[model samples]
Target: MQLRLPTSIPEVQECLADGAVPIGGATLVWAAWQRDGFPELAVSLRELPEANTIGAEELGAAVVLHQIDDRVPEVLHRAAAGVGTGAVRRAATVGGNLVGSTLRCLLPAAVVLDARAVVLEPEGHFETDLSDVLAKHHLLVGLRWSAPIISGYRKLDAEAGGPPPFVVASALHADDGGNRLRVAVRDGYEVLSGTVACAEDSADVLDTLHRTDLGTLDPTAWETVRRHVTELLTRSVGG
Candidate 1:
């Protein structure tokens, strides 16, 4: 196998043009390789500065999970902190987490944050919504978004230290007369999102959430999750 380390965007693009598979952190990629055999040529993005830095409004795809947990918004930090363990966080990159799997915590948070992804296409770099980027295969370069007024993330696992069965993220923004609430839920397979005017009471907010489709959740646990999400939103908005 040939390993190419590209320190610049142009160099990385050249490598991609040569049919080299891109790797960031390689946590998931290396595991996949071990199970399904390694690729002939792989491009390592660790050397690219833009792929590892945290900008004012953007996070490089290669930024480590722990860095995000430590530096980014609390919503993103909560998502990052649930990624696995301390060692896993050290080796997992935000880009890898997003593009590697649809079942990750960060994607839901990104959706609620109205994050856009910078994708490197054959023509040139362009911006797309995180949801759209996830739907289609794209070379993700980084993520960008304006900070919201307040945000929160919650993950529910079947058991302690196990993969989360459900993950939810909520963000609130002050509007003309009231507040706007945005919520995104990832229930194992797909992500569902909805937005509504923030309600004054937690019960009213919970009712609105129930009316807003949150994808397929177990009926037995739906109420439980709804209450949890309502509490999270309430605490975040100080309501």
Candidate 2:
């Protein structure tokens, strides 16, 4: 009902403490509203500060997607743009993407990137790994991640006229950094999360993707879909 925009971390924290939901462009919030309903008191980061800008401070501040977009048009920026359309990007904030847990595609990327987040609790201000923060906190101020060594993102959507990626695999060449593998179901629903130097080969990755968390799919049908996606990813890597 009311929108409060705060320009500083302290101001943002104060508002959060007062129970106002921090808003960053409000894309996910609005989308959910179309599917769900209003949440509670809200705050917009649009005019609050340069939440979109990234740089030394961002690396220091635990740069979020918007912040990365603000500074550079890197891999994450490309992935963020793929989210919906221009209209959505104009309003969406990186922080919102993480806070909205049901959707975990980008968050996993952040995790694989080793991004961290700075939180302002009533007790004190401290930093936590992005994944841990997402699991623990209902409210988040912003996030930060180490710059990727070698990173790429691919999505399969019906609109693309291709089979949805049973697993949207993101690989980061973080050997000197932190080798990580992130695989998630497209459309932000099914998510398989882990950090490993390598998976059980591409076939197993596809198989795991098709199985779903509860093992709900018929094995035959799962194998079909799994094979299709594996071929696709194989072509991708080959190319």
lDDT of each candidate versus the true structure: 0.77, 0.53
- Candidate 2 differs from the real structure by a C-alpha RMSD in angstroms, to one decimal, of 6.0
Give TM-scores for every candidate, taking all chains together and pairing residue i with residue i: 0.86, 0.63
Candidate 2, 1-239: lDDT as tens digits: 67877777677677777887656556556777668866567766554444544552253222344335534314455566566556655555666666663554465455445566766654556777765776776345555555554455555544454443333434444465434444333433545444444353776665554444424544643454455445544644675
Report clash pairs, candidate 2: 52-67, 62-143, 62-144, 63-144, 115-144, 115-145, 116-144
- Stretches of model 2 off by over 4 angstroms after superposition: 30-41, 48-50, 56-74, 159-167, 176-188, 198-239
The lDDT, on a scale of 0 to 1, for candidate 2 is: 0.53
Instruction: Report the lDDT tens digits of candidate 1 across residue range 35-60.
Output: 99999998877788877767545788
Q: Score residue 33 of candidate 1 by CA lDDT.
A: 94
Best by TM-score: 1
Evaluated at residue 132, the lDDT of candidate 1 is: 73
- Residue 167 alpha-carbon offset, candidate 1, angstroms: 1.8
Q: Give candidate 1's root-mean-square deviation (CA, Å).
A: 2.6
